[model samples]
Target: MTKVTDVVLNLIKIKGQKKEEAANTNERPPAKKQSPGELRLHKDIAELNLPKNTKVTFPNGKDDLMNIEVTLRPDEGYYVGGIFVFSFHVPHAYPHEPSKVRFITHPNIDLEGNVCLNILREDWKPVLNINTIIYGLNLLFIQPNHEDPLNHDAAVVLRDDPQKFQRDVQAAMLGGYVGQVYFPRCK
Candidate 1:
């Protein structure tokens, strides 16, 4: 049973020798090892097999895969015919941790980019995959769960008056005024 101190000292010695070797060779150190988060992202991207309407893009270009943008174009629902974009940021823990997701363009999204979804919050589990999350996000546009909502006003309207809520969603998606708020045309 090696003591913690002994293990740390051994690691330091190895790192020091590696640094010296790199210095002598006039070579850069290897890229920082990918964290669990990065490894999961690589796997998610490869296995995505996204729907035709959905596209994933690395905004920082190919090398920076930790951050990505997912575009969703739902075929049906209040958001139908409109394009929605969501940004995903994978933390160092990756599959061990849920990816942070924000809506870039959605009628219901607040200015702060807070997204309302069960899987991204209380329902998250290691067994749930990217496909599940993406589908849940699309459901947000289609269903817009007004019961558990980050936007209280939207939820209130949705609960109190279903027709008006649908109208408001349509107006917002069409780049019209649902009141003082002006939503850009997403179609």
Candidate 2:
């Protein structure tokens, strides 16, 4: 409503005319620039419903909420005793635009295994929150969705046989080779 702010906003739009980012583009924004999703993430983490075996920590510190690492230990599955780490890269649009995920270690799971899940892919919806995503990830270890896997080879082995998949998982977790790829010990 003020003349000065209106002028500044016009200038920002002219410089960077992203329609989606228009609302947050203000004058004297803040000392620390956080995304709209940042506040949402803070609330989500505060009221987090993670299992005892799973924990999410900000490696960069609590100040940086955009990035977080989730450590999961499934007690009753192929990945039991295995420590799997995944980083959730929360975008400014976040719930609107999905956060990226990268697995730290595994055999049935791949390093670039973000696109494997339906939730991260075609089935993503704004209604889904961090907790939902975390649960989906936990489900992966209990039952790796081989049908829609990012690693085609791993998926194939997991689908074709259960015993071989278990052997491969054990080998990979112990810092051995599954196929040609070697995995570092995550135990």
Candidate 3:
């Protein structure tokens, strides 16, 4: 009876070991988890319907969805034929928090790339998506808001003298010096 019990126990152990090995061989490595913000951004980007003059690109490739670059080429505005690129860094608290946008060649944008768009700052809401921000940026080129500006001097000029403002914008777009700052040719 002792010999028979020992044989049965050894059989059980061998079966268990075989099952464990099979399970290990069939299992795959765990997939990396995506944060809620990444999930939301993925949805937003997948559903993007960009405007005719606006295009969005990922400098870090599609694998990294947090950083984005938006290029605008307005066809009928002060910035017509000019190319402007804005970088957007979406935070982990996106939607709840606004994206950080940086672009350096507009009346409402400073030389240091500080933007003064209402939706980007005080008026931002969770309901707004990337498309909303793109439209807002496009509108800025179409109709620059001198009332709220990051470049006060440019705003003042736009407000006080429309023609001079247009000339200055043209000059800047053509890679000329505006005041002490030189602008690169974006056209």
lDDT, candidate 2, residue 9? 91
Q: Is candidate 1 or candidate 2 better by lDDT?
A: 2
* TM-score for all models, in order of appearance: 0.77, 0.79, 0.85
Residue 144 in candidate 2, Cα distance off native in Å: 0.9
Worst 10 residues of 3 by lDDT: 28-37
Q: After superposition, how far is residue 34 of candidate 2 from its true place, in Å?
A: 3.4
lDDT of each: 0.77, 0.79, 0.91
Ten residues in a row with the worst lDDT in model 1?
103-112
- For 113-148, candidate 1 gives per-residue lDDT tens digits of 778776777778877767777877877877877667
How well is each residue in 21-88 modelled by candidate 3, as lDDT tens digits? 88789896545798888888999999898999999999999888899999999988788999999999
| Alpha-carbon lDDT of model 1 | 0.77
Clashing pairs in 1: 37-94
Best by lDDT: 3
Candidate 3 residues lying further than 4 Å off, grouped into runs, are 1-29
Give the higher-TM-score candidate: 1 or 3.
3
Question: What is the lDDT ranking, best to worst?
Answer: 3, 2, 1
